[model samples]
Target: MSNYVIQADQQLLDALRAHYEGALSDRLPAGALFAVKRPDVVITAYRSGKVLFQGKAAEQEAAKWISGASASNETADHQPSALAAHQLGSLSAIGSDEVGTGDYFGPIVVAAAYVDRPHIAKIAALGVKDSKQLNDEAIKRIAPAIMETVPHAVTVLDNPQYNRWQRSGMPQTKMKALLHNRTLVKLVDAIAPAEPEAIIIDEFLKRDSYFRYLSDEDRIIRERVHCLPKAESVHVSVAAASIIARYVFLEEMEQLSRAVGLLLPKGAGAIVDEAAARIIRARGEEMLETCAKLHFANTKKALAIAKRRK
Candidate 1:
């Protein structure tokens, strides 16, 4: 069997041991490279190709033989998952997420978080995950915590501005994709001095379409942008971004509601229609466009209902 040497931070090494010991994934992939946890030092190892052993016996054997005589203190800034995998050397990883896309009101906000070989656990422990899986209060509480742990950037596209752009001939989907890409670009630019190795985005479209759209804008992502579904669950940085985006959107919505003197509802559903109608009655139809995304079908419906009641 061929052997390979892999280096990793202590937490990742401990995670590797936990995975092999059935405390993590039940089936450890063959040829897995991982770190083993010791009191003051971490031991790194590689398993021979994708073989699933019956139990933890092989892991124990490998752990015992792989022990090195020299031990060093764990680096304070080492994060396991953010570390570049074996063949990649050291590289930075980033995660991106957006909010307010489906809402009839409020601005579309996209956020990106840069995570390196340190601070992954602190983010995960703060309950950062998919924003859809969280409530507004929870997101608000966790967003600042995530920001404290990692550097991030955001882009907000307010409704009136978005409508003006759309009326000028931008397709809704294209506009959204463009805004998301621009946000990504801004984040990349902000972190360019650091030169991260890769970036991850929650995939909004098929790969070819996304790449083509980005290419049209002359914003080539250099094949290092990974777009995957449910990425936030697998990547802590993306989860942190998701929380930030959601928190910002929630806050913006609240402010918009106060500005218009009516409770603005979430989403483009029937409840939102009711809220829009109430706002129009309390204020005026002309003011509705300012507080809501006029491009939504719900906007036309609300206008029609308002006219009928008048």
Candidate 2:
């Protein structure tokens, strides 16, 4: 009943053809809007110029509107998220995400996952969305389910290692880029055997900077890599990736807390000051580097407080 019209120019139609390929309900006419029914069904009208698809099918339809058919199957071996554009008209996809960059404790984590066309509904069924939108328990419950439904990879940069990298001159943003890129590379390699055509990543930086960083790494992504804002909301793979990353971050934080015998709070803030004091008292200041990210101003401030208390 929820009808929408998508105007197809040469480019849009070409994209649609590639996305739908053998799957289109009918050929589209010029200057016609595609009518789509909600929840995963597409109805096509040649005279009216409308298309309807649901779930994975709907995603495929959207993708066609953007990149055209030529690019659709080109990366079929790669997952959808890795595709150059996310608007293709298929269900198979993959996406990547990271967490803990702003936290003064625990590890920085990057996660990636492959969502096949058939599994989009399964993911949505599990209430998969952006990890930030869900609490820790919800993420934990959903993470294993996501893993079961999709192939995934996660990279964790422990606080100590992160500090070492920072001391060696890597900025946090650069470090994040490095971790994300490396995770993506690994994910791509993992999914390449299956031969998906595309992947999408939430844009962390401007287009030029992101491309520059990718170029600097000399790592070529075979599948198309679509970069956009709020990609997690638009792409199921990205959403699944975010949940996995957040789950790992929370789990790691708990482990860090147990290792230090105190709860390590999330983020850099005044409460972190108290936690730092506790860590310094229980462990030595020298040990702080092992347990905390030293680059944070919180580390220096905590050290000063520790000295004052002494």
Candidate with the greatest lDDT versus the true structure? 2
What lDDT tens digits, residue by residue, belong to model 1 across residues 9-70?
Answer: 55545655665453333332346564443333333344532222222222222323223322
lDDT of each candidate versus the true structure: 0.65, 0.69
Compare the candidates by TM-score and give the number of the best one: 2
Q: RMSD for each model, in Å, please? A: 10.8, 9.6
For model 1, the stretches where C-alpha displacement exceeds 4 angstroms are: 1-91, 216-219
Output the lDDT of residue 310, model 2: 80
